[model samples]
Target: MSNMHASKLFDVKDKVVLVTGGGRGIGEMIAEGYVSNGAKVYIASRDIKACEATAARLNKQGPGKCYAMAADLSKYEDIVKLIDELSKKEQALNVLVNNSGANWGAPLDEYPDAAFSKVMNLNVNKVFTVTQKALPLLRNAQKKDGVARVINIGSVNGVDPPALETYAYSASKAALHHLSRVLASRLGPEGITVNTLACGPFQSKMMAATLEKFEESIVGGLPLGRIGTPEDVSGVCLFLSSRAGAYTTGATIPVDGGSLVKAKL
Candidate 1:
């Protein structure tokens, strides 16, 4: 009966999780959620210093431990090195959050080709490759209850076209959404679940520039009448990572505070 309780349903204690770009922003929020709830969280970023600093801070508040590993996920060699490093630390991984991404914004006419390429490389290609490489580990971690999970952090801009001109970022997230569905179907038989968290405006360094310009307008437009908070993102992650979300797969769940619906109206 205790196992049927809400707390037990959402329990992720002692789970092994890897969150890329986990040094800050949405990634940091997810890492903090898991760490605070007693999950051994490995947070990685291209910036080693940021990752180490974040790990140090999260470790102090944690029921579980946080570790930092740095890798530039855009390159195949670096991804390989990261997988190797992770393998040395843990034999299995219960969750993988593909949250590392970049955005390039410019007038459509002036948008550089390099910006699109770079954004796509990190946001789309890197996500696919990293998940592919992590399959063995994910498979090993599959619980008898079929609970291994891969959570892709997508954007609401992908579902609803943005008012802003971050062309590549929007496109990449849409692609990631489709990719999550495809992977979910393929991995279902392996007892691994794949899902996308389609998110809206949140307070992250990536959103700082845009929020600085239109925070009020953005909040006003939302039916929820506010920007997303860290708890908003992490609560979704907790559900998707734990038993509560075990039966959900190939789904794109919007953690957007009703922004997508409001945008359509």
Candidate 2:
């Protein structure tokens, strides 16, 4: 590919995108990346005000636009309502980024059954249901030559379990990664691509407490010698959503700056 062609390969301009849990943290980073690049983005979360605030903040920056929607994705009806509202405005969706998730931390014996259930329900189960309900829009966006992208945000902890005792959190991410692979097999024939982004620690709401305490240790531990920034995950997402990554599917691509590599060393 020529320079122009190569540049165009990573282009996501004007594409329609929906990012769940896009209120803050990694999801917000990803959303801003797309919006800045001229992709119309819809960010949905249980926190309507937060989503709206993010949408407003991004919209101010502009060539691409962003809209906000409220959906407690943990519930089936709310998922349907969100899709219904989106369906009212747009007929197609080019990129669907499932970033909404939950985490539960507890010791092995102290882990509550209810907490486990809640974590599993929000982190694993809801992702499936949201993807299921959005199939029509995803299909609408698919092309014979180009496939729609479904990037599932997962954790590096899923691949290499950390010392932390967030049993359900790790397990849920692992399930999500496998789920992406399985869905890839089924959705491939239908002109949609599925993949998991096995991400390392990023400065996000989820990792605030851990990072606050162990920022130095975590930085020292990583081969990259730094934690992830927005560009780290956003760049990978652009690659996967654009023409460049059309052929790549059913794969777990890491944005961990070689954390997994450091783990074995």
Q: Write the per-residue lDDT of candidate 2 for residues 6-56, one digit (tens) a residue.
A: 668889988999999998999999999999899999999989999999999
Compared with the true structure, what per-residue lDDT tens digits does model 1 show for residues 1-265?
7877988999999999999999999999999999989999999889999999999999999898999998999999999999999999988899999999999999999999999999999999999999999988898899533558999999898898899999999999999999999999999998899999999889999999899999998998789998888899999999999999989999999998898888552
lDDT of 2 at 46: 89
> Considering summed lDDT, which 10 consecutive residues are worst modelled in model 2?
140-149
User: How many residue pairs clash in each candidate at the backbone level?
Assistant: 0, 0
At residue 265, what lDDT does model 1 achieve? 22
TM-score of each: 0.97, 0.96
Residue 27 local lDDT, model 1: 97
RMSD of each: 1.2, 1.5
- Model 2: how far residue 250 lies from native, Å: 0.6
By summed lDDT, the worst window of 10 consecutive residues in model 1 runs over: 139-148
